[model samples]
Target: MPQMFRHRGFTGRIRRNYPMKKILKWTGIGVLAFAIVIIAALLIIPMFVDIQDYKPRLETMVSEKTGRDFAIGGDLELSLFPWAGISFSDLRLGNPPGYREKIFLSIESFDVRVKLLPLISKDIQVKRFVIEGPHLVLEKSSDGKGNWEEFGERREPEKKTATETQQEPRADMLPVKTLQVEECAIKNGTVAWIDDAAGTRNTLSELNLDLQNVSLDKPVDISLSANLDGRPLSMKGFLGPVGEKPGTGPLAFDLALSALDQLNLTVKGKVTDAATAPRFDAAFDLSPFSPRKLLDSFSVPFPVKTADPGVLNKIAAKGSITGSTEKISVNNGRLNMDDSAISFTVDAGEFQKPVLSFNMEVDSIDLDRYMPPPAEEAEAASKPKKKPDPEAGIDYGPLRKPVINGTVQIKNLTFSEARVSDLSIKISAKGGRYNIEPIELAAYEGTLKAGAILNVQKDTPSASAELNIMGMKINPLLQDVIDKDFLDGTLKAQMSIAFTGDEPNAIKKTLGGSGELLFEDGAVVGIDMAGMVRNVTASFGLSDKPGEKPRTDFSELIAPFTIKNGVVNTSGTTMKSPLLRLVVTGNANLVTETLDMRVEPKVVGTLKGQGDTKERSGLAVPILISGTFSEPKFKPDLKGIVTQGLKLPKTEDLKKALPGGDEIQKESLKDSAKDLLKGLPLKKK
Candidate 1:
């Protein structure tokens, strides 16, 4: 028994102690079962594994479907596990005839969900989506072809059931609710619609748009805040399909945008069809907005200074418009600038419509503040020759006193006040030139109308005007035409005065016209013709009125006169006095500031034939009225008569010099001695 135990010991002991054979067999079976279960789970559960180069496959698919080249240039990645999401960095899409771009799309992350339960129920559902850094360039030629519509030939009509047509189709291959974004930005994006048939194109900018709560059946809400052509625009709005409407695609929500310190408002009207243009209703409230302020904010024609912030803040307006994408109409509006307020009722056609109608009124304004600035020659000379700055002259732009409140009717018009009357006025300028049409001015009670043209050039000043007086009151009308003094009688005449010059003095120098002067007892201030000729008689001389002082030699003078330039002539008039025929000629020198006149009279009646010796023994007066207009010098003709009077002897001494008389020397000596003694001062004793 001992020998037998020793030989069989090794095998039996191994089997009993360790159980090696059974352990090895069970271990192999367990490993094989685990491998089988894992392989089955991978295949049957539809496990998705992400591939880094996945974008190529998508590009290939899109290229085939659309018959156009599609490419993702840079990195392409795919996510696995929870949801299958694909991302393509730097992607580019191409339509051969229309568009191409560079540095396309970069999708940082995304997800995809497969619905097992829905799949079993034959329902299609998407569970995931993602987006990051995508940029697109959409362009079209001026002829009207575009990349979006480039594949028109390759597209086929979609076939669907009546029920599907009536209702929005459930999202297939896309999630019902999608939230996608992470520092998602788009650079240099563009959308252009070109109609080759019409040869028209409209291009809109492309920038980052934050999309949120995107659903197939609900409104599409988006927020856009970006710069367009250097102008910042911040807008938020929503647009979506209406409730089961056949033709209506979507209705737009109110859109609010803020810029230039002013809120610009917009609203979408009812949507009709895809074939129709997008219609909108909008309102621009300029009442709270100033054009000057807006210009300042944008830095366009940028402000030169801001010493007084309110200097450029005068205008305010309120208006509303409604129309299609291409045209708009304004209903009612009003504007206020400075002291003037204008109200308008307008009926405008399309934006492109050429004909428009408007009625406006000017409530009142201060003319002095808005008058054109005084011209400066030095300021004009300092400007550059090629593109010289404008003259620092009067600025009528603000219309400080624009009394334009009246019904203004215009079809296709050019109007001015000078043309309304016989007096013509012209308005012109270097940068601005316009000839006004005949317009009826309703500011005053009468049916007043006038037209004019003004030419205010930087280098030259010119003007012309024509004023017509209609049926108006004769008295007040004259005041506006002529000066305060001249003729007090009522005037009813058609008078026209024309001027051609820049300055007031120049204009007056060039004035020329002729008109009748009708009068009812018009009086000449200094003379009374009837009283002078009739009352003056030789017998008992002239009789004075009761309690009146005797008439002086100058007081009984009478004359008639006519004026031309600054000279006065009295050649064609009758006057009665101690003197006879009288003729006066004078020239007034305004430049030298002097007035000179010469008077010559022929003695008449008792003094007429006194001695036909032709010896001068009468008044030869030279009147001088010289000085500035404000303070003129007036006195008798002293130089002409007083100096000559001192040269005349008291009497002729022919008798004393006669040979038959007592010694002339003796007589003369005696008289002279007596006169000398009388003229000399007496001694105190």
Candidate 2:
């Protein structure tokens, strides 16, 4: 039996392996038959199938799921193998009409894989893709009844896996498990980020992203780069669920990103709990942050003055913040900007904190180069009409810069400065409002203490402070203030001002605070009160003392005056010759720069009983001033007499009798003075 079976080649010795020719011929036939079936399916089946209906069916399914009207124009074609994909050419989609909704999405060329099986089997695969060249458009109406995000509440995620049917995951499908994605790439991608809430639209160009080896059981690695607003930024990161758990899985990540020429940032973060409530901690390091450059990148204009151009080049910052569901804390924070440094630590427990502190220090700043121009000067310069002249008109106020350097003490803060440009301040406050204490500063010396309440909500501030002067010189400050029109006196007064205001003009108007103004041995500049009094007396027929020569110097004109609470009171001092005694008291409203005063003049130290001999013993002058500041109406009238009451020398008679009238009148005028004084005993000598 075995020999018979072997002769038929059904057993034993394999019958010397069938003839190679016959074996190969059958294999070729079988392969040819398989190829024929495949070609028929590829070339003929798609032609017969109604692919147009698939478009509406897809549209209906989308509409049903999203509760939005969906429509598509044109037929869809699905190819079978070898170029295996779905194609939609000249396709247009929109939100259905007649529903106050407007949405339109169009595609010129699109193709997608018909099956995802190959991708799951570790092969390069894609499902449904689109390629549009410059003509694709998406539109949304202002009313917001449009596409993707406008869909109603999202469906709940499923918690199970799909069965062997190998269908697309439905809304009710199980939570994703063991998701795996192989290499994916994009080229020349462009996307627009639109924020309807903020009404902002930003476009990113030349965008590229590469994602590799993403897995739910493993870490995900990604790299992306894009050109944003003419700046290049690149980012790389790795992310994963922590501890290899699902509901309990946390997030762990490390990322590095930077904008070209502006800033570089690196961060590491982790979330410890994904269920109940999440707890997270993150540390960030930012380096080479240029304030000017960063602001410029965002199109913000900065008016900073730099000694060396582009000196504000770099800044570095490091900080870490940790927070649970209810509490948060920060530690190890430091910020460095050029030569400046700031550091702080803060911790909070559900908004309840007892101690918080901050400290800052600045190396140096130039005040004169950085401070803004005076308000009056800036305003005058901006006017197009006939602008007011700074010096010709009255400028009630002009700003003065003070030299500022030293440590500042805040509640829990201490800010130290090496030197500040163009700033001088004398500030003090009482009763929670700045009320200048009576003080005079010869020169602003060292550390100053500030008192003020800064109300950020109202965007208003009130401050008062006392600048402590250890030992300083005053000549320079006094000279500068005098030159700047703060006062019109050669007198040097050492004083400090305590004032509060949001503006320079306001502070100037209130430049008054009760501070002692000490005058050294300097004389009054351009003020000759004695000469004025002499003229008044001469015009009034008031006689000079017999032994004394006429007075010329103005040092004797003004008696010392003290200012307090807006009142000026002359000291009780008597002048020597002509025996004039001045008694003046009045209030000077500094805001208006007006003086309302009463001047009483009396004779003293006369040879004879001048007071009794003269018809008037005292001259009470009522002074009135009116007009714009620079040129004012300054008139002083004797209480009982007018200007006509004064006696005048006979100038016409002397002029007619003199050849050298201009010169002889001067000598004859003296002889006439001798004649006019003939009756006095001193004149006889």
- TM per prediction: 0.40, 0.50
Ten-residue segment with the worst summed lDDT in candidate 2?
Answer: 676-685
Judged by lDDT, which candidate is best?
Answer: 2
**What TM-score does candidate 1 reach?**
0.40
What's the lDDT for residue 31 in model 1?
89
C-alpha lDDT of candidate 1 relative to the true structure: 0.43
Instruction: Estimate, for each residue in 283-314, the C-alpha lDDT of model 2 and write its tens digit.
Output: 98998678887778868677664434455666
1-685, model 1: which lDDT tens digit per residue?
Answer: 8888886997789778687878888899998899778556644444354454456688898878766777766656543323334454555656555443332222433334443334445343445443444444455545655556645255577998898877864322233233222233344444444455555444445445664545445665768765544556677877553334323354645566665355465544454443355555555564345667667565556333332334435676666666665545665677777545766665444333233445665554333333233243344555654533345534544332222212443222112211122222222222333345464443222334456555443334444444443434333333343322222222223333344444444554454433332222232222222232222111111223334322213212233443333233344232234434444555444324344544444444344454444432433333244443333343234445456562321122222222333454544433322221232122111
lDDT of each structure? 0.43, 0.48
lDDT of 2 at 479: 43
